[model samples]
Target: MAFSGGFGVTAAQGATNPNNDFQVANPPNDGISSLSWSPTANFLVSTSWDCEVYCYDVQANGQAVPKASIKHDKPALCSAWMHDGSAVFSGGCDNMVKKWDLATNTPTQIAAHDLPIRHLAWIPEVGLLVTGSWDKTLKYWDARQPTPTLQVQLPERCYALSCTHPLLVVGCAERHLQIFNLSNPQTPYRSIQSPLKYQTRCVATFPDKSGYLIGSIEGRVAVNHVEDSLASKNFTFKCHREQADIYAVNSISFHPRHGTFVTTGSDGVFNFWDKDSKQRLKQMQKCNAPIPCGAFNRDGSIFAYAVSYDWSKGGQDPMASAQGGNNIFLHATEETEVKPRPPANRVGGRR
Candidate 1:
């Protein structure tokens, strides 16, 4: 491995690398935009800018043949699985949220996003789905209703959102981060003011902390300890490759059962860190394309990735180039050495 900053252990996986240790494909063209896994089932769900939902069976040698495909005419932005994995919930540029039954190729269209759908999160206990959109609003759906179950107005276009236990969080393009107490579901009992240094791209929290992590557009990250309305940013780090432009944060996921977290940046660098210490651990930096999303399940057993290149790289085709760079990572109990085989580029290289 090439050494640049510090002595870091080397791990490489990419467009043609599935990290499956089981199967690899020159991942197909989709410009994968979102991804998720059934909390209680052996399946994975993902969405692309093409308005299609791709599901994969979670087994060794598992082939990600499309489980159900929704061609909505407009682009789909993000998705999440139902509590029981029976259905898939998705939101998109169509300004609406739709639920698809995995058992059958059925779509149940619900509330409209009013603007481009940026992200969606599912709260199982309440049987509700939460969405953030460019329309400058955050809406919640009962899934049981034909319309948004509830709505909250933000100051700017909503960029990302997440719901963990007692709190429902939202990020704004203006960099404001809001926290709501979902125990009441209807109204956010509290809200926090974000620090002035960066424009936040996303926010995350583990199962064990009152604090949260924020990914910013300014190539930095911060940790905030918020309990009720009182909050403080305990630490912040310069977290991206040095460049003349802002480093956009793509996606973040907590280590299911450990004190760790991972993030994908616009610079095509994936970072692993000590969730509690705020220390950067390992980084996968080979991708020339920007990765938009990544996820890890509760046990360190399964993982998923979706890559999209920097639009300014070359072509203007929104769906071309890195659109097909999808990858799956699994930590097998048995040994797995992921070597970068540059043979005829079997996993499928750039078209």
Candidate 2:
């Protein structure tokens, strides 16, 4: 790959470019662990197993120019942007969480966990950074402080986490899911088992905040409601599988505006779904590499995904890396692809 200037890289198209989609310039040398879009801008941040966090400024013409990057002592597992898009917070196997100021490109350690942090979310309304770790605990921190404001124990290692204002959901190993009403952030609002039979892989809150979605290693997703009265509405559906071949559902991202969402999987496919109608909205052609993570931009105009080795088979596959699987792709969202279908045109209920 050719370098642009300073720390940035110029855009380069991929060999199997799909229509309306373009590959981002330079990507992490190893597997991508997570992707996050700034809440107030088109800027995107990605954390990877390569121990680096990268920021890119995606221009309107579909070109992603690298803006900045920072390195951790170990693989960075997850990243989340500050509310104003001025900085980013990341955590990983290093057992440390660091805040990177975009202006100066400086990083400062803010918190630490007993074990590797698996996921993190920034709760803007609460002005706290919440991190879930393999230590079987969830800790909340105010970046300005030296220690966590609060820490809650989990039943098992945290595998996935997602937050939306008053709601925070954590999916742990052993199919344990704990929901927190952030208004009462000290304790869980509810603790329950995930509907999916296998290990929980990822979780995402609905844009409306009425409920959340859980994806599992068995290629199934569960739609659940926060209220017991709406419990009947909860259901599970299958995806990221063909016949007997099943792959883990790696990531789920919701459209900031449309309330629709997408799920990317280890099978190298991503699908858009509308929970209101229990129907599939769109399914992109499968990639040659696993899509470990993805996210939609602030206004839901752009969808960015990482096409790379996910290490789903336990250890690294050198062959996949040798074929240059580390890359990012940007898909310009079309109205019909993400917009909600009319009630009349909707059909089906769970898979």
Candidate 3:
């Protein structure tokens, strides 16, 4: 509530103290890197630059503190929960991907990369875990096997990744956008240049699997369709920019049931948009710091976003120490909050 420059009423569940809603496991010494909610339970997992992963029980009374913490030798950059929610998988700067069993709280190292593992996505239907690394490679692991099932060299160092069923999308260095059919990893089904003029920061697929949204450091988003015939529908737009500075678009997540999606940025704002209509539905409360990541629950009833200091903030006016601190925002996703309506056209109007 302290940050300025946002419109509309607050959309967070706990507005009085939004930071308290995250229920951090403990005060971390460094910025938070990633966050993922359990697919079934009201639990959440987070990675931090402090080289630790904290899992919290959000349903607990009072602030949902971390129920467990898993330490890593290097800064943990990304994490993903298995489809059944039985365990968690994390990757970090140490170039290791580890699987932690929630029942026993024991971590088992699974795979290793030459460089930092920057992104992870699990496809339950295919029983595969895909990891993208700064080493310029994409590795696929089968749950039943200990070694990677496939490894494909990328055009450049990987920066962002997203997957939905049969399709996998990766954004790498120098504006390379690569799309692969999960059934065949050796060849890419679609390869294109990102529309944005800067480094790709994040990517998320549409709920319907038609295309994906790509975010960049220049505060712009590019909408891409999978089919060559639908290429005409693709477009790019600028968002998350301030009056005097351009902020990086940090994360983009699509709602589970609705096709609408939300975007977060270094500008400290989370905005909901109907990609089909290309209109922003609502602008959520400002966090007063960069939002590193965001996610929606399996049922799309709850949305979570992480607010923390970003490397991009270095060398600017000194921020209040607390302002640079980390917290998660658990916001409610209601029909009134995200569903597009009214002059925006009828529900089935878009074709």
Can you write out model 1's per-residue Cα lDDT over 117-233, one digit (the tens) per residue? 888888877777888889888887887787787888877888778778777778787677777778776665555556636677778865564767777776666666666453443
TM-score of each candidate? 0.80, 0.93, 0.89
- Model 3 over residues 249-305: C-alpha lDDT tens digits? 999988878778888898888888887766778776666678888887777766777
State candidate 2's TM-score.
0.93
Which regions in candidate 3 have their CA more than 4 angstroms from the true location?
A: 1-27, 60-63, 314-317, 320-324, 342-351
Pairs of colliding residues, candidate 1: 25-347, 26-347, 26-348, 31-323, 95-113
Q: Write the per-residue lDDT of candidate 2 for residues 70-148, one digit (tens) a residue.
A: 9999999999999998889999999999999988889999999999999998888989999999999999999999999
Clashes of 3: 1
Q: Over 4 Å off in model 2, which ranges?
A: 1-16, 316-323, 343-351
Evaluated against the true structure, the overall lDDT of model 3 is: 0.79
In order, the Cα lDDT scores of the candidates are 0.64, 0.87, 0.79
How do all the candidates rank in terms of lDDT, highest first?
2, 3, 1
Top lDDT hit: 2
RMSD list, candidates in order = 9.0, 4.2, 5.3
Q: Pick the candidate with the highest TM-score.
A: 2
For model 3, what is the error of residue 77's alpha carbon versus the real structure, in angstroms, after optimal superposition? 0.6
